[model samples]
Target: MMMLRKFKIVLPLFFVASLFISSQTNANTDPNPKDKVLLTILKYVLTQGHYHPQTIDDTFSENVYNSFLERLDPSKRYFLQSDIDEFSNYKMQIDDQINNEDLSFFFLVYERLTQRIEESKPYYKQILENQFDFNNDDIFDVDYEKSSYAKNTSEITNIWHKQLKFTTLSRLNDKIIAEEDKKKEDETYQTKSFNELEKEAREAVIINMDESFERIEELTYSDWFSIFINSISEEFDPHTTYFDPVVKKRFDISMAGKLEGIGARLQKKNDYTKVSELISGGPAWKQGELEVGDYITKVAQGDGEPIDIVGMRLDDAIEYIKGKKGTEVRLTLKKMDGTTKVISIIRDVVELEETFVKSSVVKKDGRTFGVINLPKFYIDFDEKNFRSSSTDMAQEIERLKNENVEGLVIDLRNNGGGSLKTAIEISGLFIEKGPIVQVKYRDKNPDVKKDTDPKIQWDKPLVVLVNELSASASEIFAAAMQDYGRAVIIGGRQTYGKGTVQSVLDLNRYHNLKEDIGALKMTIQKFYRINGGSTQLEGVHSDIMLPDRYTYMNIGERDLENPLKFDKVPKATYKLWDNYENFNQAIDNSKKRIATNNYFKLIDQNAKWLKNSQDDTLIYLNYEAYKKDLEVHENESLKYKSLRDYTSNLTYTSPLYEQPLLEKDEDLAEKREAWHKNLKKDMYVEEALNVLSELKIKPQYHLVKN
Candidate 1:
């Protein structure tokens, strides 16, 4: 892997990892007995992260793997399954320093290359000077084993890393000196001595480099794929992505309550970077200058030549985008068609404190109801001005109380979670203080996170709105509220099962091995509800699943590969409240209404049709029949196209929605069926909202289970 110079952040899952926020509480990292028991229980439940080879062409004939290895080693003719699967035996304990071809042939090849490099150390410079070619078809006529270079290539390759490190020291020093000189030139009056700054920068770069390499070599393909996918995803749009746990953690950390640059979600499609989803009220959304589907072609400083960002890795791209807040950056964009435009986005220090600074009200359900839309359950790092999600939620309740709202809805849908502290605090908003969540560790006892405050923020009838996107901290708050019988969990069947907690291991911070290279993020903990239940693969179950068309869509944690499974710990001591007696009646009434509702019925029928549709893998050739079938289905799939502006923003908006099922007019029913099948799911979201309305005003039972 090629190393580059850069700054760092506890990336991926910022909040969960607790990377940079200085005000974060000293996490409850102490060892305990219950944690050990839970760890034992979790050995099987926690990690479904197996790298199952999907293609049986486990043989090298699969062009993808072939191209993959070729990129890594130019002379690598081919690798066998024996080379790949040999490591199946070493499922958990993977080591690179040790030669273990017994692990797999992939290891064999890797070791082989390492051996080759080490055997010919002095000649390591040859690689940098020349390209490593496996398919010499592009360059030489020599036999595969025969290279133009000296035969002792193994020694050279093995020692290349360390030797190059030593050799590059002078180059690093020179660069440091140059940077120091530049800093002095830019200095107004006060400046650090060149020697002092140079020393710090040099140490930072070298140590970061070493730490980064160690982490990179040990990363599994599954982990590597997220970074790779991220690199690819940016070209499409910013929101859609595939983040393995590690990267996901980094994301949390990078955006923790606006700790980084202007808060905005980003995705990569290809060499081109596209903006997708923007945080509704964050810097980007507030600016209202950027839009989803707007492709970011280049990112520059307040004033600088637009850098051609094509083909750059996603991480590098993000590093470029993030810097000291309050700075100004210019982004050159490409519109949907091909129109080019440039816009300036000012970098603002994300004022995460805004998350808990206040709350609002929404009048509904024949009564004024308080609305607390918490996108993330965040906590401020400072104790003096500690703005926690729970604390803020409490304040919102006070305002709502003053407004005299009869009911309240805590919207946790699409919430990916943040502070555990906030989750407990928020849950306490509706109940008498008690344990809200149980946290288990790998080698210690599980601890009950309790709300010690004597006062309840709001005791009025409460409802928690959740969807597949609600997870982790979201789950904890919702689950606690539900377990306490203080609120109704309404919306989807369950939330996203991102229940694990991770800690950041600044491989560089603590070790200072590599300088410009970033740090390693590791999964080190798991969370559980105080009642022994966990929000893992099975997120918090809703009291009532709503009727919505999007209920048909595939999204959230359960859809993820190798997600952690669900299991429960022992129940905790707590008081449960029961007030709504018409819960089931309300659910039944809603279901009956939805059964006859037009939008609900059409979506239901569409979903059923899609369930049995073999349209995805079929073919038809009749032209007349094909055109008819394609025409009808295309319109049906987009049954609400005229009603809903669901443009993908890929091509320009069509003047009419009467586009063909098959753009080329090839298949008849097959293509039509495919379109309908994929289009049917989103109807569920509508169904969900309907379910909520059904149970909105049923008779209440005030007695409690406690």
Candidate 2:
């Protein structure tokens, strides 16, 4: 673990003046004025404001060079070893170039990249023009990271040939299976021959390939520059990134939790626009049609014909989806379960109310407990009247307290976190008054954020639910609760380990340039737990570990590329909340029950199987072998089907106090009903309830202030 320390160095105006005086030759051939200005502002911020600034030397240059190359051609599809060899001349010179605010290296690489892309477009098209032999036993390595650049043009051509064959075979296989299924459904259904299906698959590949090349051709120099700068910035840390103007707007919308259109976040996965997340109370979430893993293959507005989005850039596809609040967008989506459907969604303001704190009263084993689902630590900085998570959470706790609930569960699962101020205030609700988290800046002493308030709201037996997606502020709250013995952390092995704080500095603000140069989201600090441990890559461990599908997955800060290392500092002086002295006994009982419970055991087995399957990257190119392998995996997966239907006998309803409000708002009633129904099927929630039941401490006990 590396603890954060601050460095305060004020460079005089003459220092920047001298840098320009010594680098006049480098500017004569600069690619663009915006790039030059962007370079100056970026360099100044990274060196002066970044948390862990690496020295601008040969080592740093090498990292930037390699990272840029990887970003440009991640699959090793465009660039060959020959091109890399030719580009090595500037590998060790990028650092010096940065010092001079030069961009000669970028221009050189961009020219070559564009040329190569134009030259290579014919290779794939030519390969897909012929039929592929489905009988050939071949394997394709789907993992791009393990692949190396082609040694020569011949190898590049061969790679394209194999890739086209795999694509064509997959399409042809699906077509054949669909025809077979149709014949089974209708006795008079006409079937096409294998040759005809293969021909159609090849034609589809060519059409898709042509559109892909066309989209690739639409990339502007600024887009490439954005990637270049981000590559340079991310070398400092994975969280430190350069967002172009367009992306900055998107970031703002996401942070604000208000957007038009279908209210779903989309990402490009291998030329297909995939739904990453659905805003909780947004149109998409309310529609209950689109899912996280669904692929949006086509989009249409109003009653227009659907336009294919496959082989289109994610940004371009998003433009078609986003519209006025009253508009309508129809999406043709392919579900992960191999089902296709066209879903029509009416665009709206996407209220974002569902992300707020919502509580449900659960009656389990003849005892009532309150469960509060907090999606994120959201806050509105600009508007004082806007509802924040901390304030909303406090009110919810008060409501739950009035209901005489025995124990409370704060659900932080899938919470990516936001607003550190809100997290600090929420921590105050649990503890009387002490340090909750420590923030360390470069070369400066760690600043401990303390909750000075003496009032402890609902200091009862508590449980905090977390998973792999629980991050940053979520980690802080959970770590503080665990450190103080205030609450038992449950779910997953640990939370998402993003402990660093990022400050987005607008590049245009630093310079007098008229052009919008976007912003730099740089890591400026690392936060540590009150107990001296930094959550950086390790995150906060669950007090009571529970296995899920993500248990064996590498989806944390540690798994991310170039994350800040974890380290410790001196622990803050804070007193523990000793309300639950028999906490260890409760943990033991819960573990024992989980081991014997068929639901949990099945989940662990399913997680193991998922991990094993993910590790196998090679896929059979032959249709028969590929189909057999998929069939076997799907059949093996059927045993865990009962997990989805497994429901706990726990009955959930709004408290009597909240019942009137539910009746007043039917929408709220539906939301609560849907949430409670999901909770009944949630194995993790069931275990948390069990843990609460086993706690020796009762809600009536008053915890002594520190």
Candidate 3:
């Protein structure tokens, strides 16, 4: 799967909708009365306040119809062709239903899906009762998007058999290989027969399926209703989403950057919850067991019996993993290499320190350069005095200047944006003062967000590092730097083109009802660079482009459905930085170096190989053929193994002020050590420093270290 770790909490600005509901409530009793009110408010706000509201017509209806069904049964396994045929009747009529606040289509599909899910349980149980023939030459195409739904119950049963057999065969192969390896390790080791191993794999699949169904059975009506609502909301834009009360609470916690848990983000993949990211300095990271891609199979509290979580809902699985601070939560993980490990962690308040700005000083040749890695433009919306990225960045710059670092590299790679105000503030620190970005609401003239502060904090040579994952506020900062000729933008062909600004509107505020109607995160404004170009579809083009893993992949805002189109506005008045005499020369020199660099060449080749591998999703169900395919890919992957071992000739160290803090806190020390080590291996940072070194400062602007 293509893992795009997108941080979608962009610019948390709130705008109260000016909606007024009449005192006349619905006299007719309905189970979900709030649904109608929510839908009515949602339509009004989206059409009136959205930056580019989509037309809700027959086309919109068809899109939602297709999207909702696909989401309900993505594998094309649950619902049959008959079910699809029935659902298609209201495909075009959905627009009218939505306009009238009618829930007939939603109710029909929801009820049918619930019925189909219950019916499909026996199919898997019956299929797994017998051994799968691994010797047969069968191929399972994993491209479910292209696969057709089964015509009848018999056809669906056959499809289930193939899918279960594919799942079992893979496990059987793993068991066979493990037995052989054990036999080789000890000459007198006993090995089980193929039939015996096949039975064990089948049993394992049964357990997993049962747990999956159990989790599905636990889904409440609210869960399904949220999905139906989102299916409509997402058709407007990818980022715009409806957050039910439960999900909205989670979003708030995530934005606050403090949670009482083990500090690992989990995503449901197939029947397992995979570890997406581990918060640095969190309990799990401190314990040093959980890793990204590891499947969390079971979770236990304190010394209790482990509860299998392989098929559990992500929200439920998290409940088992998270606990009050000082409580123990043990997790059973199925590692990527097929080994199982039980890890215990004492839950704590995991303050996401890594989400803030962190800086490191590195020495190249004889001069020092500073690298500031800003994960996001974070700001506490609730507290005015709370730490903000802009203030932290300003302080870090002053500290770097105190250390007499000659150049600065602001690393915004993988920073999927946060606060817009902070981005503009941070941009002002580099330049004297000018309009940073233009924000345009629907049918309104562009409002210029400027940095009125004329004091330039860092007049020295500056380089900004961005990649395909740098989005929203990150784009705003990078664009401002590029437009004003302030910083030399490097890495990736373009940044993530997410120019739209979103504002969370509390839906309950529009009504006098005591019930919580949750909030709507809708796109309210589209931002543009000072040079008039919108970074909506085409992100900021890097001045010094470099090849990365996602070089050939279809990523960013344009890849998303119904993204706003790129357009231009009147350019804001801003003066270009004329202090750097060899700006063009620095870029040209880096391009020449990157052209012949073996490491970059290997990276480009690896990216192409990865793209091809991702495209070839077909799996050989026969054991021998499956093993052979894996072996071929494994050998091919060995060619790019050296990429991990490549390192640069640079020494990175923590800043002087942070040195004392690191010595006191071992976790902080360890985090910085790991960061410095990665910096040493980073070729991009090395190249960025090279460009910074080549940038010749104007004679009058040059300063001597005190």
Per-model TM against the reference: 0.52, 0.89, 0.87
How much does candidate 1 score in TM-score?
Answer: 0.52
- Candidate 3 lDDT over residue span 153-175, tens digit each: 99889888887887677567767
The ten-residue window of minimal lDDT in model 2 covers 1-10
Rank order (by lDDT, best first): 3, 2, 1
Q: How do the residues 661-704 of candidate 2 rate in per-residue lDDT, one tens digit apiece?
A: 89899988987888889998888988898898777663445433
Candidate 1 has its poorest 10 consecutive residues by lDDT at: 649-658
Task: List the global CA lDDT of all models.
Answer: 0.49, 0.81, 0.81
**Candidate 3 structure lDDT:** 0.81
* Collision pairs in model 2: 1-566, 1-567, 2-566, 2-567, 5-442, 5-443, 6-442, 6-443, 6-444, 7-442
Q: Tell me the RMSD of model 2 versus the true structure.
A: 4.0
Clashes of each: 95, 10, 0
* Between candidates 1 and 2, the lDDT winner: 2
Q: Of the candidates shown, which would achieve the greatest TM-score relative to the real structure?
A: 2
Cα RMSDs, all models: 18.9, 4.0, 5.5
For model 2 the local lDDT of residue 647 reads 85
